[model samples]
Target: MAYQSLRLEYLQIPPVSRAYTTACVLTTAAVQLELITPFQLYFNPELIFKHFQIWRLITNFLFFGPVGFNFLFNMIFLYRYCRMLEEGSFRGRTADFVFMFLFGGFLMTLFGLFVSLVFLGQAFTIMLVYVWSRRNPYVRMNFFGLLNFQAPFLPWVLMGFSLLLGNSIIVDLLGIAVGHIYFFLEDVFPNQPGGIRILKTPSILRTIFDTPDDDPNYNPLPEERPGGFAWGEGQRLGG
Candidate 1:
């Protein structure tokens, strides 16, 4: 009975979030079991271009180090914000969400080439949080019950926390940069005086992932709330 309940709960996670989070956990598990090594998973330009190890491109964003506090921390934020974004702003628009993932990943990859970073999964998580916070600007956020801020500052707060931990802030910054570029393109620019929509979800993706019977009048998330989840009511961020 317990196993059945757990399975049902797992099934409730939105599709894109479910798949990505599962991949991250399974990749980490594979490493923990000694089935794979970090050396094989970290992004390598020469190995990818010359040796044709294309799997590295995706695997690099799967493993988030060992299954300790850092790993758990990243997984929590990744799962929560990814699910919120999917079930909120991106609801009934699975194809567009997938496109956002693709767009973010592409930009990160291009940036990764110049930086000496290996694993990008953490940065990818930050990007999701960044985008979600931007869309729900009025949603209040609390950081580990210590700080309170509006949605737009969430990404920077996260970066500050990373700095406090002595970790490099480059990954977080990269995610923020990519997230802002995407946000400006998808949400900001098109609404400007003479700006036009620059990013369009491909028809093929819509055919493959979108729901055909989406309600025309449905609003998954309101402008001021994040899919009905309360963030600053004595709950810890990422809890």
Candidate 2:
């Protein structure tokens, strides 16, 4: 019964988040089973363009590394925040959410061409975290019970922690940069004086992802539920 309930709960996750997290997990499992190698997954522009190994472009962002602490840490953050963004602010806006994914992935891939970074999954996770943090600025967040701050600082705090972990800060920085650009254009600039909305969601997206609303005034209040769910309230350090 317990396992059945868990399976059902897992199925309730938003489609995009569920698919992404599953891919990451399965990718890691495949690596652990020696079915595929890390070399095949890492981003390599030369190989992608010249050798027609185009799978690397998408695969790069799917695998973090072997199954261990870093993989677990990143997967937790990815599942939590990705689910929140999809179910919270992006509720009923699947197409727009997907566009954000495409936008971020494209920018990161372009940036990856210059840098020697391999797996971009961490950066992609950070980008999602950054966007969620900005959207929920008033929400208080506690990290590892050692530090506390408003939501917007979460990505930077994670970057600092990454520095402590001896991991490269470049990927985190890249994610932050891309995330900020998207936020500024999508959310900030359009509301500013003399600013026009440039990042319009396509009509096809609306037709596909949007539901006809009967209550136009309906606004989703920030969830005040307990943590260990999706809202990040009372969330702990590890998964």
Candidate 3:
């Protein structure tokens, strides 16, 4: 009975979130089981270009170090924000969400070339949180019951928390930079005077992943702030 209930809950998660989170968990599990090593998963330009180790590009964004507090923390944030974004702003727009993933990953890969970072899964998670926070600016958020703020400040809060833990702020900054670039291109710049939409979801992606929604009056994210709250009500960091 417990297994059946868990299965139902798992099925409730959006497809993109489910797939990405599962991949991260499984990759970490493989390392824990000695099936793979972190050395094989870390990003390396030389191995990728000269030795044709192209899988490193994707794997680097999969493993988030060993299974511990840090790994669990990252996984929770990754699954939560990814699910919320998919089910909220990107609702019925699977292809566009997938496109965002690809766009962020591509930019991070380019930036990775210039940085000393090995794994990028945490940065990718921050990118998701940043994009979601931007799209839901009015949502009230509580971080670990210590700080309360609006959604837009989430990435920074996470970064600050990372700094408190003595982790370098470079990874968080990289994610925020990529996320900002994407947000500016997709949302902000397109709405400015004489600005045009620059980041378009590819039609092939539409055909492949997007299901046509027939409702013409559909609201991807309805701004219903009952009791002065948004979709993230009663949720908090590490809760």
Candidate 4:
């Protein structure tokens, strides 16, 4: 059946992105179905420590809310850029990608303690967008087909858009901050003069997610060719 085939194709998305998106969808559906409540899933340090509701740590980053425009928008962006990053810069580096997720999530959680943020799914999405945007600095993006800017400015643009939507910019700012930290430590700093790599991916993670002989024939797709108008332009020039 077409539906089954489509499902199968979607299931073939890179592991980390696929898993994260699936978690978000399922959590949202559960809440919409009234099977779970946001209060139960939100991050609460006291509940996590005293009542042992540690699942909140992960769940808080899973549900964005019941099915709606904001949820859909976040999910689409999450899936698209997460997949692009995995298949582009991280083509064969599954362990490194996983480590980035771990690092970002850990940092966000720490920041959440000081802030009043309950759900961090949006922030996590922003972190992904920020990392992807930074790594692909040359990529050209069009915001609602009205504004054009290079990739590095994408996160800030999103923050401004969030402000326009009357959403708190705190979550977006948290994501951007965490993302910049990761980018600086993992990508930027190590390449600096006399700078050594401080954020090495763990060997155990490498062993599990990355194999020596995996996908020998795999090759990353070319960056999105720039030019021409398209819906939600997020592409690079040339094939």
Candidate with the greatest TM-score versus the true structure: 4
**Candidates' C-alpha lDDT:** 0.86, 0.85, 0.86, 0.86
lDDT of 2 by residue, 105-154 (tens): 99999999899899999999999999999998877787776677778999
Candidate 3, 17: how far from true, in Å? 0.3
The global Cα lDDT (0 to 1) of model 3 is: 0.86
TM-score for all models, in order of appearance:
0.90, 0.88, 0.89, 0.92
Q: Please identify which of the two predictions, 2 or 4, would achieve the higher lDDT against the true structure.
A: 4
Clashing pairs in 3: none
Q: Model 1, 13-114: lDDT tens per residue? A: 778999999999999999999999999999999999999999988999999999998998888888888888998888889999999999999999999999
User: For model 4, what is the error of residue 72's alpha carbon versus the real structure, in angstroms, after optimal superposition?
Assistant: 0.6
True lDDT of residue 181, candidate 4: 96
Task: Report the C-alpha lDDT of model 3 over 86-127, residue by residue, as the tens digit.
Answer: 888888889999999999999999999999989999999999
The sequence of per-residue lDDT tens digits that candidate 4 reaches over residues 1-239 is: 99998886776687888899998999999899898889999999999989999999899999887788888889878887888889988877999999999899999999999999999999998998898888988888887788888889988988998999999999999999999999899889999999999999999998999977656444443346456533235767562
Local lDDT at 122 for model 2: 95
Model 4 vs truth, CA RMSD: 2.3
Candidate 1 Cα errors over 4 Å, as ranges: 214-239
Better of 2 and 4 by TM-score: 4
Candidate 2 wrong stretches, greater than 4 Å: 211-239
Q: Which residue pairs does candidate 1 place in steric collision? A: none
